[model samples]
Target: MVLPIVKLVILLARQITRPVVHRLGALAKRNRTFRSVIVPIGQGYHSMNFTSQSRLFGVDTQTQAEPLSTDEAMNLGSKLLGEVLVYGVSASFLLYEYHKSSRKEKIKAKNRQNEKAELQGKIQEYWDVTEAEIALLKRKIFELEVKNHS
Candidate 1:
């Protein structure tokens, strides 16, 4: 029946289009780029009770434990601080570079747009002049015909 044929056509169309659509969506999502900082915090602190404050990738993580000695807490704090500083600095540099590149691209795009607009205007002016010249020639031809007829 025609209905079956139509259904088969529709199914085939969907199968043909689905992968292309999915790929385009993935590409679009990939193009939306952003810089993020990821710091790995181990599970050791989760099981322990200690009052320690440390910075991790520009984030402050505090855990409170009454049983841990001062020396032990200081050691852990120093380790965490070192890790955080290293990761944070790297993240900052990466973010700075990304922003710099984005700015440069924007400036380049603006310049290109300006150039395109100027070129378009010039083309339009050229067309206008050509049209006027054609109109003038047609008018002259009409005048000549009138004179010949007289």
Candidate 2:
């Protein structure tokens, strides 16, 4: 009861705060880079959680550099080369994490199969006993027919 209520309150607060945060961010002069975290909600549904972190070097924050002219910014498609490096590193990390998660998923599926096979083996004795009883019943019926004929 309490947990659901708490979750609802939190959800409401987050909903209310999000727009204000976005408005504040849009007003800021600095460039913004974004990345989203994907959360699976089961049955093919997914939700994204966004976390905004600003990059500020200690001395650079205090020193205001002149904004780049359009041509300068375009030529530095490198965007200080740091942005490219950051993106490269982040992409590599995301790829590695995805591979690890896929490996874990394969392992989980294999374990589930092993568990189901183990359970089937446990119940096998019942079928084995039933088959043996069926064979015995057939032999007894054959003997009874011989007796009847005699």
Candidate 3:
């Protein structure tokens, strides 16, 4: 019975956390940190494959003919370069926005803390004034009693 409950709790926790974790992972993957590594490695592998298959087998052979024309290659490279530039700019913007949001949250938290402290100080002051008033009333009553006795 306890085992089933534990499993259920774990499942619920995963369900709740999965979306947040996935989003963060996606963001990281899209960032420059991952791009610098993934882009070069991917390009290198693609180039190696293309070279081995196209150049190693000669141009006269039908099995290993030239894959792309000069114009085609230039167009493809330009398109890829454009895509990388766009992605880089967008990722940088995302990072900047993330930092801005975090800063705003910190400021909000600090303001809340200050407000709470001020409220606590006001409560303490109220209690102190109330105690002083009670003390004064007690003193007045004692003086009246002494006068009546006299």
Model 1 over residues 3-99: C-alpha lDDT tens digits?
9987886576556555544453344334432101111121244223222333424433554433434334333433444445555665787799999
Q: Report the lDDT tens digits of candidate 3 across residue range 1-150.
A: 899987886576556554544443354356756445445544554565676767666743335323454334333433454445555665787799999999999999999999999999999999999999999999999999999999
Taking all chains together, the TM-score of candidate 2 against the true structure is 0.41
**Model 2 Cα lDDT, one tens digit per residue, 19-126:** 544443333223433211111111112111111111222332333344444333322332323344444655787799999999999999999999999889877977
TM-score, structure 3 vs. true: 0.48
- The number of the candidate with the highest lDDT is 3
Number of backbone collisions per candidate: 4, 0, 0
Better of 2 and 3 by TM-score: 3
Q: Is 1 or 3 the stronger prediction by TM-score? A: 1
> For each candidate, C-alpha RMSD in Å?
18.3, 16.6, 14.8
lDDT (CA) for every model shown?
0.57, 0.51, 0.63
Which window of ten consecutive residues has the lowest lDDT sum in model 1?
Answer: 34-43
Better of 1 and 2 by lDDT: 1
Find the 10 residues in a row with the least total lDDT in model 2. 35-44
Rate residue 75 of model 1 by lDDT.
Answer: 38
